[model samples]
Target: MVHLSRMCTLVALLVALAGCASAPEPQGNSEILNLQAEAEYAYQLALLDQAETLYLEILRSIPNYAPAWFRLGNIYSRTGRLDAAILAFERCVELEPENQKALYNMALVRLKQSHQIISLARRQNGVDPQVQRQIDGLYQALLRLQQHTPTDSN
Candidate 1:
């Protein structure tokens, strides 16, 4: 159920952003859309680094483009670059606070951070300080997000 909701939210956000772009768009930069399509294809093919580069190129052309930021974060998360994933997700959220997909993705990444610490604790007697600090930070962000965001099933 949660996965379905996230997928719906992601699709809605993509459609919404594509329609109501503030500065970016298929019209202003037709090539940007083409690049996005190429990036997505690379992503589907599991060519994460290539997709990241393509998304970064799109961002360079349109800094405020939320979809690029969100997609970049997705690639980062899949590639296990947690810090960069969070930053990219944060950028997307900054551009679109109502982006439920980004919000949900942030929560997933934070959970992944904690899972790393849990795995570390199981392997050794203690967790890494850096991982602990990152988990703490993500916890705080989740707390703040809970206040502003509805504690609904989504």
Candidate 2:
């Protein structure tokens, strides 16, 4: 026969496992899933404005959702809203540090902003030293990102 202490331990383990097995699904999981599907569909259709609104709605409910952040960044980048794009991508990276796609998009947005600044400076006669320094910094950042990013052969 088993010792009393060992029997108690076995019973406790069984009880814990039973509780876990009976745990109910989280509330609103299906709602969130539906919203995510709608957002992805809008994004695929290139309905950027609609997608952006949907993403914002999802984020209000789940602020830490990295995919919504990434999609929002893409919409902002395509709409020429570089500043907003950077912030959205940065948030996505904060939530999922290993997300290479968000990092790459951030670099692209920064490069576009740099090009715009340079163009404006040229049109105004000459580049300001401070502006030139900022552009150089952006270039250095891009080089660093490229060096650290892994290439996908496929």
Which predicted model would earn the best TM-score? Answer: 2
The top-ranked prediction according to lDDT is: 1
Per-residue lDDT tens digits for candidate 1, residues 18-77, read: 775565565635566678789889988979889989989978877877777888888888
Residue-pair clashes per candidate, as listed?
0, 0
Tell me which residue pairs clash in candidate 1: none
Give a tens-digit lDDT track for model 2, residues 1-154. Answer: 2234334533553453345546764555556667767988998898889889889998887787777888899899889999999999999888777777788888888777776765565456435887777756766666676567553210
Cα lDDT of model 1 overall?
A: 0.73
Residue 58 alpha-carbon offset, candidate 1, angstroms: 0.3
Clashes of 1: 0
User: Under the 3 Å rule for N, CA and C atoms, how many clashes does model 2 have?
Assistant: 0
> Candidate 2, TM-score vs. the true structure?
0.67
> Model 2: residues >4 Å from true position, as ranges?
1-27, 127-154
- For model 1, the superposed segments whose C-alpha errors exceed 4 Å read 1-28, 123-154
